[model samples]
Target chain A: MYIADRSGEVIYHPDQQLIYAGLTEESPVADASLSDGIHKEVIDGIPQLVLVKTVGYTGWKLVGVIPVKNLAADIDELQWFGVALLLFTVFLLAFVNTHLSEHISRPLSRLNLAVKAMEAGKENVEFQEEGCEEVQHLAHSIQSMVSTLRHLMDDIIEQEENKRRLEMEVLQSQINPHFLYNTLDSVIWLTENGRYEDATRMVNALGKLFRISLSRGKTVIPLKDELEHVRHYGTIQAIRYKERFEIRITAEPDTEGLYTLKLIVQPILENAIYHGMAAMDEDGEITVHAWRKGGDLYIDVQDNGLGIPGEMLDHLLDESQPLKHSKGSGIGVRNIHRRIQLFFGPEYGLEFFSEPDEGTLVRIHLPALNEEQAAAYQKEGTGYETKA
Target chain B: MKRKHKNLIQLGILAILSLLVILSLFIRDISWPEKAERRVEISVIVRESDSSIWSEARQGMAKAAADYGVELRFLALGESNSVSEQTELIRQEIKNGADGLVVVPAQTEALEVIVKDNPKIPVVTMESSLEGACISVMPDNVWVGEQLAAAIEEDFSEGHVLLVDAAPGSSGIRARLEAAEESLTEKGFTVLRCGADFTVETIEGVDAVIFPEPESAVHALQLLDQNGKTSSLYVAGTEERILAGLEYGVIRGVVAWSGYGVGYQAVEQAASAVLGKELSEPVVESVLVRKEEMYEIENQKILFPIGH
Candidate 1:
């Protein structure tokens, strides 16, 4: 059964149910059917016209009804076909969804992982770039950005390196002449006090310092020259301290051939003295231990003077800034650390440990070199001998 | 002269007596009304254990045995290639009073001794004929091999031909391969021989491949596929190999002989000999099937009597 209302409302009636149970309510459907200008529905069940304002005078609602048995077969067939079409469309959509997700999600997940790794400061991060244009472009941009960042870091390091060398030059200009002048002042004071042989010995020590320091201005000096340079510096420091600081040099004979960066050991020794001993009163003991261990040349500038506090130990190794509240004015321990890092690598830099007042021990590790310095040390230090 | 003639007479009588003794020993008894219908049993021994050609041959033998009304028993020649089992089977039948035998002998020389023991027993050979058999009915292998060569020459006249066959020591395969080589070479075809086992390795310089029989055609097609290398491969052998090659588009052409016909003819010939009937003339047929023609359903018959 079908029902239609020409009004705005869509009215549906089951004809069999309606006929078996007649319309006992007075709805005026019988009166409007004969006298209305409402056109007949072309097919059953569907509403053909709105009955709200018909051309003929009828109420706002007009109704038409068809029997229930009509069009049932067609409706059932239509429902079945609709369900089949819905299932087929759902299957096709699922297939397309799976395909599209694989294409889009896989590369996106890789990109997400790469970005996460980069954010965590990983150096080498790779991304897959062989998909759609946008993904490929994004990957390419990320790779380019990483490359630029690496290049910028390298530039920053180079600039900081130049600044550090400038500071080292400034320290050297201040300390080298000051040390020479102090040694010359001591020699003058000794000669006026009628200690002529002692003044002559000071002159000899000063000459040895000058010869080892120059070495024709070659940056890499044999272990002997490096040792002699440190010895001369220590001798001058010992005299200035009024013989309160004792200098002991211990080394192996065969290690004279090994080369070290010029002035590396001397600067470390200076840091040990000023930072470890300048406030001391009675006696300051300093020992320079040089030896060859494995393939490396080791030099230790150990002192029994007032040691550095534990909290300030890390500051001694930091190269990003100058040492805070430090009194060694020469191209000090920081310069030595920087030079070792520049020449060999960061791993070969100066390392140290110090307690409150027990002592401070500084160990310098460098690659070993060859025999020419053994002769240079013998010719230079006639009385200076190495323990076998 | 008298002494010599007397001794010759005695020797002739002894020979006749020996013949009589051999006949009595092998002959089985029969019950008859007017004329004695001798119920002589003949055993056919086949070499293979399992094959389609063997099954078809058994079918044909059953049909022929029904037509001739002769009792036929099939004994497997067992797995040994020396025919010792077949010789032992013949000896067992002879002791059991069997009158005649049909044998697919493994070796030609072994058959001579088996036949000599009962000279009058009338041994008919099928597929494998020995020196002493009274009648031999197998595909004339030389003729079949020659037909293959002719078909190949007609199709591909100018390429190097590789002939693949089973073990060359086998009497049947050796004769066929030699004939194929001889016929192919006579027609100016450079014939290269390869054993069935290692045909692929030896197919290096060959242009077209020809195998002697149906059993090894698949292996031949595989070798051709490997050696042909996108070039045209021609196969001449079994229907199964040809069909497979055609299905996979492996071979350009195939030359096959009918296994069923060989089986039918062999049985008919053997049955005719046992029944004292006139033999039907054997027809040897070889056909060249191009890859397209292999699928023509009219030609799908088995082409060898290997089992029966």
Candidate 2:
């Protein structure tokens, strides 16, 4: 409240000191010199409800001022508080929204990861088979599809194995007819030369060789029986060679019980006598020695005769070679090497060590299978235990 | 990589929220007053916050506050003349951390004890002086008295002059009364002493009346007008009614001082004392304004300040 005389001289004021000091400007009330009334005005740029009343007959004007900002201060504070609360609510909602979205999408995300792994050619993809019914059913269906694919793949492999075994049987059946014709020639020559005892011995050896070679149409035989077949072949061969070269057959003590592919040693012995010992005069010797080395059986057909040259020895087991100098099976050494690998994996096959004029050693390698494993192998083709 | 990116976004949001909390605590106007650069706070305690008596003084203090970068608050008092109540207000202002005080003292001697007890808060008084006051800004009482006497002497050489004493307990009003009495006596007039509560019986034989205080000047003028007494009145200071009295031919002369100057210098001196600056004692001018010359530019500025 403020008071001023009729002529604007200040009489009293809340800040009367400034009016008396004459240091402040006149307020709008004083400047207007208002009469006795209530008024609305702006004082110092503040809207105020002012009352202009005369102090009795004194002609003094009293002015009251109230700034509007003071009236709405609480409202302004409430507005700011409302804004802060709204911001907090929005932040909390966003936080919860993300979590809820993750909850609904979690299982789908796992399923997608599994499917992607499968698409990237992974063989072992795990499906959780959880979450919504659609996702679980999809996982189950994919697992069943994978099981069917594995069975089909196994059937295809079995078919391929059967085809390979049939091709090997065809090669085994092509044992050369020249060996039988030559043995018959020896028998006929002995009978006409008046060596009837020698003829009978040769006939007996030929019959034993043929019986063992037939072996009930079986592809696998015992090691002792294989040695017997090779011995009969050697007797017939010695009679044909007119004792120009001697044949020796021996085996390690425990090796004769092991199983091997039939007709394997007989072919190698035939090669040794005809090709390796062809140039030997009377001092030629062919030794058939068999031994068990670890879990494998090895038969060495060695001839102290003319050995193969370096160039011929490198490709002796090459499948591309069509023929060889042997009066035995035309399937040749390369075919025999391949057939052994097909039965016992590639680790068991023929290995040749030869030198010119020093003789040749043809080592036939086969798995040392006991009786139970031999039966399994003859039935299922490759049921023997493989080396680690 | 996608997971890492999402985590980074969450961390960014958390960082922003943390930053907002920190800003709200430290930077969104926590209202902690700055120690080194904040304005010096001063509180003015007075009998009433809305009274017109403090208008000019508040303006001057406000001007000084603006100039010195000081913060000022005027606390209103419930009791106009209660020493204890004003003293408690002073304590409250000091307790609220006032650096200085501008007191329009109601009881000079009694309030002096409170002011002196709080020596750390510099004090400047208005209208009167207190012993504990670091400075006081007031109109010179002797100058006002002599001006009122000189204005009276111009019209009357001799008369039964009734001297009215208002606020006898106030030292400033008492000095003004004594000075006016001495000046009136020296001018060869019959000076009669009277209290501000005078009845018609006291004014019966009076040829002239003199008021020693501004508020009482207007009050005495109304009493004379009511009694239909036209004896010319002289006053040591002027209020609005005294000006009206001058127009009504009831007022002979008015010795008016500029309250604005006194109020301005009070806060100026108080702020100076607070800042350890040298004190300036300013003289507030008093003028003898008559009805005929009240409109003159020179006398009007002092007698009727522009826009109050």
What TM-score, over all chains together, does every model reach?
0.34, 0.43
- Candidate 1: Cα lDDT at B38: 52
Question: Model 2: which docking level applies?
Answer: incorrect
State the DockQ, from 0 to 1, for candidate 2.
0.10
* Residue-wise C-alpha lDDT for candidate 2, range B1-308, written one tens digit per residue: 99779868976785676565455444434665654555788888764433454564565567677878888887766744456777788888889888899886667777788877888889987667789889777788777777777777788888888888755545666677678779889989888887757776576568777786656566666666788766678876555677788878788788777755665677778788888889976667777888898888666656665442
lDDT of 2 at A49: 68
lDDT of 1 by residue, B38-111 (tens): 55466777654324435555555665566556577777754534367667777898788665677666666777
Where in model 2 is the C-alpha error above 4 Å?
A1-124, A127-388, B1-20, B23-123, B157-161, B174-192, B201-207, B258-285, B293-308
Model 1 chain B worst lDDT window (10 residues): B299-308
Q: How many backbone clashes are present in model 2?
A: 29
What is model 1's interface RMSD? 45.9
Candidates in order: C-alpha RMSD to true structure:
41.0, 18.4
